[model samples]
Target: MISSVLPTYNRAPLAFVKGAGSWLETADGTRYLDLGAGIAVNALGHAAPVLVEALTEQAHKVWHVSNLYQIPEQQKLADALVEKTFADTVFFTNSGTEACELAVKMARKYWYEKGAPERVEIITFRGAFHGRSSAAIAAAGSEKMVKGFGPVLPGFVHVDWLDLEAVKAAVSEKTCAIMLEPVQGEGGIRPAPDAFLTALKQISDETGTLLIFDEVQCGMGRTGRLFAHEWSGVTPDIMMVAKGIGGGFPLGAVLATEAAAAGMTAGTHGSTYGGNPLGCAVGAKVMEIVAEPEFLAAVNAKGGFLRQRLEGLVAAHPEIFEEVRGVGLMLGLKCRLAPGELVAAGYAERLLTVAAADNVLRILPALTITEEEMAEAVSRLDAAATALETHLA
Candidate 1:
């Protein structure tokens, strides 16, 4: 039999019928612990009552309207984002790729409007995963992402990650912006050190280059902070956010300071369903929950517990895992075996995990996962490691 849908993803041979709070049920009634959490989209966990209520209520009233009109839901979400982060303005998009597109455009337009039309080049780092759009692929500059695509986009300048000297050399007057991920997600959960971030900020300030942070995967509550850059106390001129902001709904946003967004006037950029009412409603509720001080504190505590347990696992099975790295709930285990092999083993153990580059396994549990769920997740991982060892032996 042929499949109807486009085979874009190498999907697992499993179909989940329902999910609730750290667990997913397959069509055949088999339950699995859901540590992936829809690739970190379900920050409040699956089928959270607060998110469900918000979505249901908004769906009953209004689902979408044109951007020409004043959508109260959109305004409320924008207001919440502005209040929480360093941004003074917000532009909603349907996904992180769109937000990345806007961020690039906004940076170029800022320089253009300031009478420096030649300053259109955006300096991006290697191993950074911005998104999948044309601009994003170019910004990422990865051969795996840009190989089959036609001629790559022209305005992006790629450099090695953490190479401060290279970044300094790259930032000529033609450079419009310096874009990077505070914590590189698809690049194998590598975090830019706090000192390195501060250095980048200082260099950007000295050179008047706009700094953009693609926080799509590490933002929200994934890092036990509102945004990962907050941990370094180094803010970007513009930031991209998504994945968890809608609590499993599809929504993304580009946030900018006032001066950074000065070039975005009427008719500059717009989306038909960017800030749709339903998405904004759910996003507002997500903000309310994640922005709570107690909730953030709990995430930090849970992250500590999970990291400690994972360290123990690595020590117990040195042949399986090399080390554990990453911050907060967004953790990664560097494996001695191929990450895909461990992923298959995890499926057999009825535990879901995500794979990343450099033979790393990503453990992105929901922010609201309970202590018991964390323990179970570790135990399942232990079993998977044991199984792999036995098979290899």
Candidate 2:
């Protein structure tokens, strides 16, 4: 039967009707342990009571109010973000893609306001996924993403990942910003070396170019920190955040220092549904929970446990897994077998995982996942690997 939805994604065969904590259920009551966590969006797990209460209370009071009027909820969320991070100002958006768009615009406008409009080229690294929008796609400049899109947008310079020499050669008076993900999620759970990130910050400072960090997948407690860059002790001039920041709702934000955001005057940018009262109310509650010292410490401890278990898995199944990499809950199993095959096997074993480039299987569990659930997930993964080995034999 034909479906009304666009076939943009090669979706799985299963459809879940409900979820709670780290588990999901089908209509017939089959349960699956969800390590994917909707690709790291459900940081607090499914149907979190606090998030539900926040949304319900906000829904009863107000759903949305235009930007023309003062929205207290919006102001509160922005204040929380500013107080916790390096940014002094924030612009809300409906998704990470929209935040990326505005970040690019803000970078270029900064240069334009300085009477150097030619300083519009943004330097990006290879194997990066910004978004599908025209500006974001052009900034990424990946052949696979930009192939079908007509004439690529200009003013973006693409370089190999971690090639410091290449980045040095790419930057010039025309370079508006140096943008890259601190942890490349879609590119196989790669974390930029801390030294390299620090070097980039130095270069940006010396050249007077803005630095942008896309923390869409690795931020908001996914990496055991409020933001991934916090581990490096380096900050960006502009940062894009989403995913877990909303708990489960659709919300994103572009954060910038007052100096970097100077070009954004009144009427320069706007989103009708970006900072609605409902989303902000829920987002504020998410911030309150994820920013606590005790909660973050728990995340770090769980990450260590998960990493140790994964190391054991790699050692036991050398024929199936080559290595285990990544930080915190955003771990990846670099598979000797095809990642898609492992993902399908996991489905058969009633465990959910996501695949990434470089033949890696992502294990992005919710921050609140219990120790018992983690053990069960590992047991299922072990079964899946054993099944694959036997089938191949």
Q: Please, what are the lDDT tens digits per residue for candidate 1 over residues 52-111?
A: 999999999989887989999999999999999999999999899999999999999999
Q: Tell me the lDDT of candidate 2.
A: 0.94
Task: Assess each prediction's global lDDT (C-alpha) against the native.
Answer: 0.94, 0.94
What would the per-residue lDDT of candidate 2 be over residues 18-131, giving only the tens digit for each residue?
999999999999999999999999999999999999999999998987888899999999999999999999999989999999999999999999999999999999889888
At residue 387, give the lDDT of candidate 2: 92
Clashes of each: 0, 0
Worst 10 residues of 1 by lDDT: 1-10
Error of 2 at 354 (Å): 0.5
TM-scores for all candidates: the values are: 0.99, 0.99
Number of colliding residue pairs in model 2: 0
Residue 315's lDDT within candidate 2 is 91
